[model samples]
Every structure is written in C-alpha cells, then in structure tokens.
Target: MSLSFHIGFNGQCKEAFEFYAEYLNGTIGTMLEFKDSPVAASVTPEWQHKIVHANIVIEQVELAGGDVNPEQYQKPQGFNILLGVKSESKVKSLFEKFAIGGEVVLPPQKTFFSPCYAIVVDRFGVPWKFSCGK
Candidate 1:
C-alpha cells in the first residue's frame, strides 16, 4: 500500500489546499468534515475555522489534513515536507509560492548536492524543503 503524508492544520487546511490547488493545479480529491462525520457531536462551534478532514492531490500526490482541537493543537518539534523538482524554474516557482506570508530560511540557490535548494516554514508553521534535480 502507498502511504500518504498527513498534515494537522489547527484551522487553515482549506486555505492551504486552496493555495496548493491553485498554484500546482492540484486536485481536491475528497473531503469529510467533522460535523458531517460521526464525530460531529463532539466537535464544537468554536472549531468552525478548522477543518476536520480534507484531501488535496497535487500531480497525483495526496496531501491529507484536518484540524486538531485548539485545546489539543500541539506543536511539532521536527519534520518537514520535502519536494523534489526537475528544474531551477520549478524551484523558484514553488519557493515563491509557498513563501508568501511565510518565512524563508534560505533562498533558492545552488547547493553542492543539488542544483538548487531552499527551506521555508509556511504561514501555517509547516516546514518544507525544496530542491531541483541535479
């Protein structure tokens, strides 16, 4: 079985999915909300901004996500979403796209191991690594 990556969005999953879909032409495969699921009874109105679950596919890769109850949205210590690109243009394009309202730890540039590499923490605090094929 192919395993997919999961992201926990405290309350901005829809926004992230929208941005990725728009920029990468990623398809939103399916969605299931907490209020629509059996857990609806347990979800509160305050969690309105958060998404219970959303599946967005970019170039066939599935990025799954949902909101963690605010009272339980724990911070992550480490881990990052790594992206492999085939060209310098792709690196620049993706770096700029995800860097909007986000922090860039390093600008896209050549690294000894790869043609280009960059690191960034998106507005949602999810760290990402971008690299162009050598």
Candidate 2:
C-alpha cells in the first residue's frame, strides 16, 4: 500500500500549499476551496474562501492538506515531515527557503547518517527536516 500524509492548517492551507508547490517543484493536482465544497455552509463566511482540501505531487509523493476551523486548530508539534534528498545543494537551498520568516531549529550541517541535515519550521507552522544522502 502507498502511504501519504495529511496536514491540518489554521486557515492557511491554500497559501502553504502554493508555497510548497513552488519551493518543492511540485504540481498541485487539486485545490478545493470551502466555498466550492458541499460543507461550505458549515464554515463561517470568512472561511468560505479558505481551502477545504489541497493535494500536491512532489516526485511521486502525494501530500494533502486542508484548513481547519478556528476552534479545532492547533499548533503543530511533536513531529516533523522529513524529506530525503539526493543533492546537497538542493537540501541547502530548501533549508534557506523554508527558514525565511520561520524558526530554524538546526542549521545545515553534516551528520552521521547524512551528508547534510537540518530542521526548520515553515511560516505556516509546519516543521520539516531535510536529510541529504549525497
């Protein structure tokens, strides 16, 4: 079976997905807004334009996310989405890009298991870890 991940955003799914698509060189296969979903009536007027669901494909990996109601929103913690890359330059580039306006937990450096490794939290509050095998 194929495995994938789904993230819950605090009303920033659209923007976050867009950013991820661009930075990761991924393609957005689907982006469904709340106003276009059958559950549109359940969300507040302000959230009508928010994203109900979004999916992107990055190197054959599928990533999905959606906006959650304010009452149900929670800051992401205790986990990180790890990306295994084959290029050191690419890993460093991504580390710099993802660190903008976000917290950098660990700067790019060589580790025992990888040529390069780092951790950063994106502006959308999603934690990410990069491991370069090259």
Candidate 3:
C-alpha cells in the first residue's frame, strides 16, 4: 500500500497547499471548500471559504491537508516531513524555497549519509527535512 501525508492547518490549508504545489513542483489534485461539504450549513459563514480538503501530487506522492477550527488547531510537534531527493541541488533549492518567510532549523550541509541535508519549518508551521542522495 502507498502512504500519504495529511496535515491540518489553522485557516491556511488552501494557501499552504498552493505554496507546496509551487515549491515542490507538484499539481493540485483536488480542493474542496467547506461550503461544498455536506456539513456546510453547520460551519460559520466565515469558515465556508475555508478548505475542507485538498491534495497535492508531487511525482507519485500525494500530500493532503484541510483547515481545522481555530479552537481545535494545535502546533505541529514530535515529527517532521522528510523529503528525499535525488540531487544536492534539488535538496538545496527546496530547502531555500521552504525557508522563505519561515524558520531554518538547519542550513543545507553535507553529511556522511547524504550530499545535502537541511531542516526547516515552512511559513505554515510545517516542519520539513530535506535530504539528497541515497
């Protein structure tokens, strides 16, 4: 079975997915606003425009996310999204792109296990680890 990553955003799901699509060279697969869901009437008018579900496809992997109510939203912790790339340049570029308006946990550097490696938390507060080479 294939695995995918799903994230919860605090009213920024659409913006975050759009950013990921551009930065990761991915395509938006599906986007559904809360207004389009069966529970639309239950959501506040302000939240109707919020994303109910969205998916981004990069290569063969799919990243999914949705907006969560502010009260239920929590800061991400404990784990990070690890992206393995084929080249150092790709890793570096991705790291730089993700670092824009975000925090850089670790700058791109060479390690015994990989040609390039970096850790960053994107503007949406999603932590990512990029590594190049097997």
My TM-score estimates for the predictions, one after another, are 0.90, 0.95, 0.93
Best by lDDT: 2
Q: What local distance difference test score does each model get?
A: 0.81, 0.92, 0.91
Q: Against the hidden true structure, what lDDT does model 1 obtain?
A: 0.81
| Total backbone collisions for each predicted model | 0, 0, 0
lDDT of 1 by residue, 19-86 (tens): 87887788997667776777777878776445788898877788898888877786544888888878
Cα deviation at 121, candidate 2, in Å, is 0.8
Across 52-126, the per-residue lDDT of candidate 3 in tens digits comes to 999999888999999989999987888899889899899989988899999999999998988899999998989
Worst 10 residues of 2 by lDDT: 2-11
Candidate 1 weakest lDDT stretch, 10 residues: 43-52
Off by over 4 Å in 1: none
Question: Global lDDT for candidate 2?
Answer: 0.92
lDDT of predicted model 3 = 0.91
